[model samples]
Target: MAGRWTLARGVIHERASALDWAMDSRPRSDSRARECAGLGDGLSPAELSNLTPRAQIAEEWERVRLPESDRKLRVLIVGGAGVAGRNTAASLSKFCPQLQLVIGARNKDKGVQTVSTLGGNSEFVHVDINDFTSLQAAMADSDLVVHAAGPYEYADTKVLEAAIESKTTYVDISDHEGYSRRAKSYMNKAIAAGVPAITNAGANPGVSNLMAATLIHDAQTENRGQPQKLRYNYFTSGSGGTGPGVLSTTFYLLADEAVTYHQGEEKKLKPYSDKRSVSFGEGIGERDVFLLNVPEVASARRVFGVPTIDARFGTAPFFWNWTLLAVMKLLPVEILKDRRIVQFLSKFAYPFIRAVDVISGEKAAIRVDLECSDGYNTSAIFSHQRLAEAAGTATAAFVLAVLEGSTKPGVWYPEEPEGIAVEAREKLLRRAAEGAMEFQITKSFCRRKEKQGMKLGWIN
Candidate 1:
């Protein structure tokens, strides 16, 4: 039997959100039909017939797999024992087995454990992110540095500054607007040191930035239209099966007001407000996403030359989003900003988050919606069954790009043409799409304007 999936935007019924399904099983009884818990929550069927049409990518899984580098570069990954770090390290070893992996962690046991699992040449080094000398020491003799230690909400640029001073190529998974902005400000120093750095290079900020860049580039070069409004909508199930560590990051972001560009001017928007119901292709369906403080919003404004660009993010079991709103209204910003407090909150919420992850099953997707000046809209969508693997693959793509000497000497965002050439964008995305079940980029994905006052807002 076929899988049945239904999505209703802005509504929260976590139990039903996974949807009803049609299945045939060996133990089927004539009186009752079996209900199935869906796997590949984002891409079980991969393509949806009802979705808006686009020229989608079609590549075999290994087609985009990058060649192993013979340079034998050694990469020092700070916080490598953590979830994000481990994922990135796993991908690096998988794609570029020739490169030596240095897993830098404050915890020796965890780092050593992670190193033991990788197939390539790898080792673990002890380093404290807060201690400048320790951080510098870890990357002292390495060819590059990957600052996977994150939450990045209140994180100082100790690692980035150390990277510049040490002249090591740098990449990080930071998604915070403020932290990445400060890192970007170190452009001249990185260039002076003849170092290449890519900040905000995770899944949404990383792969999503490259996706937005590709969309805008194709629009201008191919005479599509003057690219106007760029809206980034991202969806992740439960904690994205990425563990509860991400909770602190999101909770900490509530302290700062989100910023978006408007008509070439900066506009301040309330975090988790400005709700937009977006359809993330097939199985993931439509979700109500709200404005969030993502670095790409501000950085992409400069890189893509767009005045009206903003980012929205929505996560599963819908009440989780509502819970954030509750936290904002009930707690003061100062309390949310406190690292210890947020860490405690994250730890407290882990069991609940873990429960949701079990049902939600780690599915995730990114939809980059671009509204051109021509009034027609073209968009790109990427979906993955596993968020950890996808995030790792995206970050690993950026790491490999920097390793191959593709990025120039400067602290750059993934979307910057100078940092990652438009020509190189496809390859980056190709590698980023490594384990993704479904990914699409089309200059011609269009939607017709619905007659207003008929069935207004998000009905389209």
Candidate 2:
């Protein structure tokens, strides 16, 4: 019987036919039966039927191919003086020597220092994100821009607007929900300018989003039904040795209500109210995770079509989480929402937070679980010894993909197919997974519970 196969969510869907029926009727464990699930070769049924199991066809899919061009690519990193930005510059310099690198910073000394540290075809440009003219001028000479200078909670779209105006590709590690949504609103303008822009391209939102996509893909490929739920759990040991910007970001996140999508509709939950125990697999084991306003929830829900999606995060030296809970309970909504007050509070707590960082060291992990029909569940876990390095690596992987012409001219989240094509996904994953102490995708049969509630947080 004549039939066609289509690829969606990284799975092949075959049109029903007599051959399909025959293939389904056979036991999945049988080698010949397994071959039937594979993409069949472009041959007549008679020819296909005579082929051996080892000779079964692999489907040829269309790739998002880019035009052949030999122009030298240049990447300008906004906030290149910061820790994450410096790490991204270093990674790009080490991994992508073909590209010219520019560091955009408001501080000339810091920018020069970062450039000196990165060496080789790297230079510094004095440009402030708040100054659109300066940003646009800095971006004018570059092919792409990576925005790493952000708390992003109260950020405007100045840098993004500048990039669009300059017709330069853009990427940012923004984790704030509001800023991410705002950045996403520039999709049309980005496409019109023929520039690809990606937001939430950091570790949790970036790698976590990709993990969810991969799990869904794996489940569908195994004939598991559509995913019904997706849960993201993340953990970091004491601010991951990053500077005060992360602390400010976390404080702002704690102040906001968590947004989750349930039954294909949006729902708001009280921050730090509903908590769950999630296992980050070996090494990291189990930890308590609480609801947070992360960007991945909405992005994953829309991209994967999952009915229920939520993201939760926890920190090591567990009292930090309790402190956030306490702040959420004690602080007024207006106070929590005030950026100035939040910044002041974060600064006040910085000394203690930094001390915790000294004690906890920098370790981070992310777990993404997907539940589908027939009790089929799959998860992907990634852990690194240091959060800053992991974030840098993940961001660098995305930059490389853009430089390699993987993304289309549109604003997208990392998990979206248009943001990173299937051909580039594997390469990006490989690069990001480097130096991860634990990185694996597994079928979870039973939910493991090492601890139950907030009361247990004291022990770890």
Candidate 3:
């Protein structure tokens, strides 16, 4: 989710617009299948067929793993002062000790302080997200560029454009629909420019997108004989250990409006006003949820054609979530348009919310449910803290692998099985195997009857 606390009213409208753009811009599954069938223009059928043996691509992807090697890599952490940026940068520095990390931001003091606090082998430089010149200068000679600083509103497309121009492999912890769409809008440009850029590399857009893609692909295969209906629910309990909590909090600030893709058309509604409850996991129990159009729902619907798609949010204190929503609805949507409001919210409200996250540990979880064939259902529950770290770590690892020529180049989202998804999934499984993150995958027998059928017991 987008995480600025101040833009709590009208930001939803902008966020929805961005999400719509990404969903609308997505290439259909059939078209993608055809494109993959070709493997691009250059290779002859024989060469393309032999680019890598089926076993090789699979075995290598699984065995080689991520967080690559000990080689000295110059990495640029854009928005390194922000939560995701610092958390990712710190992890990178720890795992890849040789990485020459640099924090690029408009605020040099903050950047310096971030690197200092992270205590990594890193430095800082000033760079503006909307300024092409500054971005170009900041990205110079960087092996990888992680765009962390964003509200990604109508204004921040240039940072991404500049990344393409700089020919630097890029990744972002962005939940902004527009950011993902704008990034995808340049698919040809990125390919033409010979640069690899992965969008929505954060939680929802990152892991959630990948999870939805994987589940849909499997269901379409397993239930090939029947028409499948996909219903998606992505819920988070709180922001993780990362400071600033910029990623998820920003989405709340923008939650005044509800935007969802219904029957191939975009629909809008008021937020907070539509209160609902959803079961997260077995032991964690059920909690209150509210509508927030996550990028995954629209992307999944477009890619999977799921009739009912929903992305919901739940918090620790149910009333707090409701109150926040009420405030968003009661306030003048445009009154916050004033820069001072954004600044004020950013400075004060943002800190207060972050404090809550810290006090509460921001412990979170996500449940993805898929219904298919003869009313059969399957699902998986993922942890927010683990997912957030994996989003940053695995994304960085895969980007590095792509740069190092370990994976084939192509336009890909986090969920698409081209560059990162496969490798990231493997790493994620290994993490689960190590008991670092307890993730459960289940398959259940479900039956749907005529008018009134048997209903499965859900957590709520």
Candidate 4:
């Protein structure tokens, strides 16, 4: 399974020039991979000059190698068999090859498959989150832990507690508000144990929160007045082209009520009930988004003091939306709430999900809109051609930041300064947006449905 270490779109990466990201999506060859892999520790000016922009960037990352003395930085990726965890492992392998990676998954065969693709310095370990001894032992050996085992509605702080007990730095892709609140309750314990932990570190909850933070941070820094309204709009094409975890998350979320904030008041509405048409900039255009119970909504209100906030998500091709709505309408609340049933259903539907993914493609868009009281408005839009890839980059960025000592010991949300320092924000954004087709932080409204010229069969 060893192959070229590539982002989804194949080459252009973090902080790449606009032209570089705009390059063709076709991937480099195996010969090219071998050439790059065999490169020496440092390249001469003449050799560097001969390489393409893509190679140069890859070389630059490779050059940031861990010393022999510092090579023991083991990262334990719990739930490594899941879509998000696997992608995060891929990103980590691509960007930082020096450290050891331990895939802590209950599925031995699946984890082994993930590890094989990660090249060297990677191995798999069996870990059941429900088994405290198994989870604790895995964390005890690793310096850092990434908890991507989700459908956080069914998740508890037991994993976080284990990480705290092991005194390991931790982060998770938990998108559920209840789980986030539960994880927050362990802040004191995490701090006391010297375990710097962050929750809600996925694509939307991860990168989207950082985007909102940037918009509000820039606004207030320039005296644009307090943010009055904040809206998070997200779109992902068919099944998000990932594993069962994502599909299961969608199914499990049907049980919860969507939470929105209005002028400091909290409101709970039916999930996937409220729909709004939002533009995701150029490539994605306008998508009909629905209200969902996302963690960032509560985090925005609690961390940023934004008076009003709401988070909405949309997916395509449009029929899937109807299918979810129908399920919510027909299924019993008790059934939706029971995770065992949901897990079974999610797996059962996963094949069809993958089929839709083939037709719809896996692109996704994220838009964070902020309106300030002083008549100021701004947004940050990030659109990637693949959801899992973007999620991986986002998760890996946070992991790198924590490893680099950017966070203090405690459980914190993405928007919080403790979880991500204001200074390191730009680097994280660039890293996360590595393969994105569109990544912009604009003062102007970029959410309007901007049209592109259609290419009719015979039209020039």
Clashes of 4: 0
Of candidates 3 and 1, the better by lDDT: 1
Which rank order by TM-score, best down to worst? 4, 1, 2, 3
* Residues 334-384 of candidate 1: C-alpha lDDT, one tens digit per residue: 899899999999999988888878887888989897878765455678888
Q: Model 3: residues >4 Å from true position, as ranges? A: 1-71, 117-121, 224-256, 263-265, 336-340, 384-391, 394-411, 419-424, 428-437, 447-460
Q: Tell me each candidate's TM-score.
A: 0.82, 0.81, 0.73, 0.83
Ranking by lDDT: 4, 2, 1, 3
Model 2, TM vs. native: 0.81
lDDT of 2 by residue, 1-460 (tens): 2222211222222322213222111113454344454545575565455433321111221222223558767899999999889988877766666568899999999999998888678899998888888998999879889999988888898989999998989999998878888998999999999999899998878988888877787777777777899998899888786777888888777777899989889999987768898887556778899999888998887788899998898988889888888888888878877988888987888788778777887889898888886566666678877898889878988888887788999899998889988567766875676556656555533223423231211112
Best by lDDT: 4
User: Model 4: which ten-residue window has the lowest total lDDT?
Assistant: 451-460
Question: 141-185, model 3: which lDDT tens digit per residue?
Answer: 787788877655444667678878888777776676656776778
- How much is 16 displaced in model 4, in angstroms? 20
lDDT of all predictions, in order shown? 0.76, 0.76, 0.56, 0.79
